[model samples]
Target: MLPHCIGVYACGMGGAGMALATDATKIASNPALGGRLGNELSVSLGWMHPDRTMDAQGPTPPGFPFPFANTASGEQTSQIENYPDGALAFNYRLSPTLAVGAAMVPGGGGETKYAMSRTATGQMGFGNAGAMYDSQVRIRYASLTPTVAWTPSAKASYGASVILGYMDFKSNMAVMNPAFTGLPSSPTLMTSGANELERVYGIGLKVGGVWDLSPQVSVAATASTGTRYQRLDDYRDLFTGPLHLPPNFGVGVTFRASPSTDIVADVQYQMWEAVEAIGGEQPAQGGFGWENQPIFALGVQHRLSDRFAVRAGWNYGPSPIPDDVVFANALFPAVIEHHFTAGATYAISDRWEVSGSAYFAPKVTQTDPGTGDMFSQFGGGTVITMKQYGGQVGLRWKF
Candidate 1:
């Protein structure tokens, strides 16, 4: 899945401000913050570049006659390198303690494209050999949320939003045709084939609350149900059921360390294990065998002057895919575990400001034990390594 910090201010703080109202972007992290932002609009654009490589080695699986003479031992780079991200948000006050807002936020998805298919059945083996059918998969998601925030009392606020989500999915898998293995034909093991991308939509709900314990401290919590998407009938063979996003929840605390400085900490959980399409064991359900994931983030922001401020933070989340399923998850490796971020904002005038943020994630590598299972996607003994860098810039106007 994509990183959670897609907004300019959120990215700057390593996604830690669930209890503070920064701007219209607050609609994303915690709709309850909408009532805190008077009147504002925010627009942002970002660039993300991730470098990934796959290394495969083999003593081929038992009884596997076709050893892929050309692809048996080699390293290949993923063709999918760059991605564009952006967000838009607007909030308007409806009453002394009521607010209404809307936002276009980034949901999470993953994509990968490999030049040479991993299957051993190339031209030299069985199937026609031209460019060695490419194996690729792409999935994307975005949500439009209409929210309402209510502050019935001085110390607490509540909010809710209707999550209208859209998704596009595509997959082109290359596998050994079971027809050649004296077994019944299986769509999951068929030769490479092209399939049109499918567009699907779904809806979910999100609700949150914020409470002020004291003048200098605040706490907040938010939760959302899974968005159940329409089934991708076109590639039913590659997936056991519709691809629905997993449910998630988060809690955060904001501490006003001093008048000029603030510290924020957040903890989040993703219930991937509850979603059949994402958490089920591989081969049996065509799933990635992902476990539940927990993420922790910490950020600090200090005002340097009346018109300038700077922030930095750290974010960490362990990979959800277990070592036993590495081969099955090669195409969608979500192994990034640590992120370092920094950003600054400058006021152009009383009504407008510009902000920019950048992040760096050091490289991480994972290799699967060579079990050599015939049903595994990449065959065992596959090593995947990845690292990423990205930045976002934005303009905010307070009227």
Candidate 2:
């Protein structure tokens, strides 16, 4: 699942939120912090819940033999009742500047469902079969990373980390009402599953320096680059075609505004263009390649006292899916252009802390040309629209 692989907190923090990850317990930023372990071991646990809603524009006119044209107004929407996921991580310090760690996190997946009773007329045939259908795609990956950091001097620090992991993908699609009679009782559908437990690896190098411009002020900057994932073939079933994990890089800065507050900002770019659909690779099913997108984030954190703290942040990005490629799968649908989020954290004791956060994505609209603005040729003409929201809570314990 994209949520699991990207880190549950990633939903709200974005790529730049790493500045707040000062300890080994938070998984949002660089894992090298895990190497800062003193003489004790550390562990962290996190959980997330997501809610979503979608509203779509009715299909275009011109009665044709397609799915969209079969309805009074080929438009459909839905609200997901519940969506939940989580993660866990552990780290051990072998020396003052070296640490090893392992973590289990949810990646990302897609889901969409629609139900309606209606009829329409189009060029291909009378539209009534594809009127109702439910489809979904779920993909997930778990990773383990070990890191080493060298704080050779008080002014600068550097490190390297490696990631190894496994991936799984499953897809289910069904056309609730097939047009013809005497056909299979179940809705027309296609399903596929694949599990690839391969040795995937990534290396990251980070360097940062602190300049004490004055006693009460300081400035710092860090930059890193490495492959996030080499190939996504192991989870081919999750996509309409083959895809590859692209390289990523980020640069960020932190400024101390006051004795107990700080502001952080970062801009990261992922070479999403390197990713191509599985179908695109084959000679026949011409691919609808996705374009690269840039993600921007900004956050602020305040220390309330010796053991209490709070933070808030925001992020935005362009949709990864193209408008022309509309796959009616339950796992994912309605990819949009932006996301919004907010969150906070509190310390329960000297050794434990808890945090909570939420995310919201606005609704998006699109039209399928082949389906003729409103219907599915297989069943009834079913029009679809979608949106999403998510929340998370986590616990951190430091030894």
- Best-fitting candidate, measured by TM-score? 1
Residue 70 CA error for candidate 1 (Å)? 7.6
Q: Candidate 1 — what's its lDDT?
A: 0.78
Q: Report the C-alpha lDDT of model 1 over 1-399, residue by residue, as the tens digit.
A: 857585888788888899988878878778899978888899999988888877654455445554432255377778989998878999999997999999998887767887666555532233443444425678999989899999988889999988898999876655535456532222234323253688999998889999999999999999989677888877676666777888889999999999989899999998988777778555545676888899998998889998999999889988887766766667777888899999888999989999999999889898777552443433566777889889999999998
Which candidate gets the maximum lDDT versus the true structure? 1
Off by over 4 Å in 2: 1-15, 25-28, 35-81, 113-134, 173-243, 278-288, 326-331, 334-338, 366-386
What's the lDDT for all of these models? Answer: 0.78, 0.45
List runs of model 1 lying over 4 Å from the truth: 68-73, 122-131, 175-193, 371-378
TM-score of 2: 0.67
Q: Each candidate: RMSD to true structure?
A: 2.6, 7.0
